[model samples]
Target: MTLRLGYGTNGLTDLRLDDALGLLADLGYDGVGLTLDHMHLDPLAPDLGARTRQVARRLAGLGLGVTVETGARYVLDPRRKHGPSLLDPDPDGRAARTALLVRAVEVAADLGAHAVHCFSGITPPDTAPDTAWQRLTGALAPVLEAADRAGVPLAVEPEPGHLLSALADFHHLRTLLGDPEPLGLTLDIGHCQCLEPASPADCVKEAGPWLRHVQIEDMRRGVHEHLPFGDGEIDFPPVLEALASTGYDGLTVVELPRHSHAGPELARTSLDFLRRAAATTNGAAPC
Candidate 1:
């Protein structure tokens, strides 16, 4: 399977959507991890249908695949970053988050995206773990149904510091969902390095069957920083090899939102780095 390289809009936060798409296309990216944010797609914008159609047309013209990412802070709550999440104390807040994700599922369907990436939000203070899990699953249930109806996969990302923070958590989510077919994993390599006991490659290998999407970035061991290619301790070649071994054909998005100004260059460099690493690991090129 051909490994697809995509860039996340997080890294292009400063650029307008049109400019971001242009940069991604020019940089040889095959797709885009379109973060649903106010500055970018503006999911809360009126006339979402029209905007979705417009984006679909533009991406088609550019021959770029799309993946909806719903990790935008403050989209649902202006006062707090990622607040009123699935595990929020209030039921209305949980419903609001679910509604947003359902809209995202519709957008992904309209864009013909392979999947939409979501996450388990942080549990509030003094919340019981079981209660948090129940709340998160309850909130996600309708969203997953909407995704199934829209013919899009709902890929949950296991993030550091979030309710679901590792491969085991992901497995638990899948099991909780009764192993639903459309439910899958969006494995963020850097997060795995930061949170999982296994190496990123091992994590991917273990979660191979459920893996549907991927996010790649370098990060120091035990830290949550999203670093550039060589800045962190990750051994990316084996990670890529594991993905290849699993026959993962989904987009492997490069996410480094903190380096917006340097996004284009970083995207190009990261793609080149991954290609060279894959070649070396596959024995097609010398290290």
Candidate 2:
């Protein structure tokens, strides 16, 4: 079994998009986790189609794969990070969130990305759980259709403090989504370490069928902060081994969103650490 390694551009927010991709390719990474944000391939930018095509060419020339991501900190609302989410009380706000996701799907298709990762936002203080669930499902309707039409997967991640914060929450969403093949899971190994009842490896095993994308980082149990490998408590070898055992062919991306201050250094470090971890599992180098 093999796993391709990539790094998230959100972590490289300081670099130009081309420079970020070039740096990752030069580091021998197999792909990129491309985050759509105001500064990097903004989904709301005019001439987005042309920009996407250009990005596709650059990636092809670099011999790198990509996965689209929609977790930009303040893309939707400049003042509030991740505001106007799918569960927003106002119908227009929910519609806008859905539109952003649909645009993500369109970009994924254009870039030949394997998946588009997104999340359920925090539930509004005044909303009931059932109402939040309904709102989420309704908002996803068009996004799902766009994903299905584009032949790209919509991989919903379970964020630590968001509305859907666990593997079980993803399961519930799958049920609500009618288990569409294009609707899948973006399994963040660090998130499992932080909040899951099961070990990260076990979570990988259980999410095998639905897993479409992956994000990797290290974190202490019950702590939501993303940490560098040795600084955290996760036993990575077994977790990586479990992903390989499941025949997951997509990129297992390094997602250090807060490490952009030292982006280049951290990117190099992560690849080396992940390579050693993968070597422990298979006695061979990972891509």
Candidate 3:
């Protein structure tokens, strides 16, 4: 079993999109988590279809795979980070977020990405839990249908402090959607360590069947910060072993959206750390 490594473009916000992809390729990353934002690929850019095709060509030339990420911080609302999400109170807001996700699925299809990563944003304090759940499911119906037709999986991530904040929440969502074939889980290792009752490794085992995408980073228990490999309390070797045991063929992507200042160097170090962890835990190196 081989576990490919990738890095998120959100961590390379300082670099131009082309430069970031080139840097990741040069650093031996197997894939990239392409987050659509105004500064990056800009999902709303004019002639986006042609641009997506061009990006596909670039990735093909570099021998790198991709997973379309829709968690761009300010893409939806410049005034607020990750605003107007699936759980938004207003119908129009929910529709806008859904529209963006649909576009992301289309881009993922064009790029041949294994999945499209997204999350239900924070629920308003005044909104009832049941109402928020209903909003999320209703918004996702069209997005899931789009993904199904495009032959791409919609990997919904469990975000801390969001409407869906844990593996159980994701399961609940899947259940509500009648377990749509195109719906899958974007299992973030850091999130598991921080918010889950189980260890990151255990969470991987639990999420194995529906895990279509993964985000990896070092994180402390109860904290939502994304840290470098050695800075956090997570024991990565065991986690790597668990993922390997699951026969997961997708990329374990490093996602440090806040560390773009040192993206090139950080990307190199992150890959080395993952390789060493895999070697130590599994007795063989990860490819």
Q: What lDDT does each candidate get? A: 0.88, 0.93, 0.92
Over 4 Å off in model 2, which ranges?
283-285
Candidate 3 residue runs with Cα over 4 Å from true position: none
Q: lDDT tens digits, residues 18-116, model 3? A: 899999999899999999998879998898999899999999999999999999888878887788888888899999999999999999999999999
Candidate 3 C-alpha error for residue 95, in Å: 0.5
Error of 1 at 268 (Å): 2.0
Q: After superposition, how far is residue 66 of candidate 1 from its true place, in Å?
A: 1.1
Ranking of all predicted structures according to lDDT, beginning with the best and ending with the worst = 2, 3, 1
Which residue runs does candidate 1 get wrong by more than 4 Å? Answer: 283-287
Per-residue alpha-carbon lDDT of candidate 2 for residues 1-287, written as tens digits (9 for 90 to 100): 76799999999999999999999999999999999997789899998999999999999999999999999988888987898899999999999999999999999999999999999999989889999999999999899999999999999999998889999999999998888878999999999999999999999999999999999999999999999888999999999889988888999899999999999999999999998888888622476
Better of 1 and 2 by lDDT: 2
Best model per lDDT: 2
Q: What TM-score, computed on C-alpha atoms, does each candidate reach?
A: 0.96, 0.98, 0.98
Model 1, residue 29: what's the lDDT?
83
Estimate candidate 1's alpha-carbon lDDT, on a 0 to 1 scale.
0.88
Clashes of 1: 0
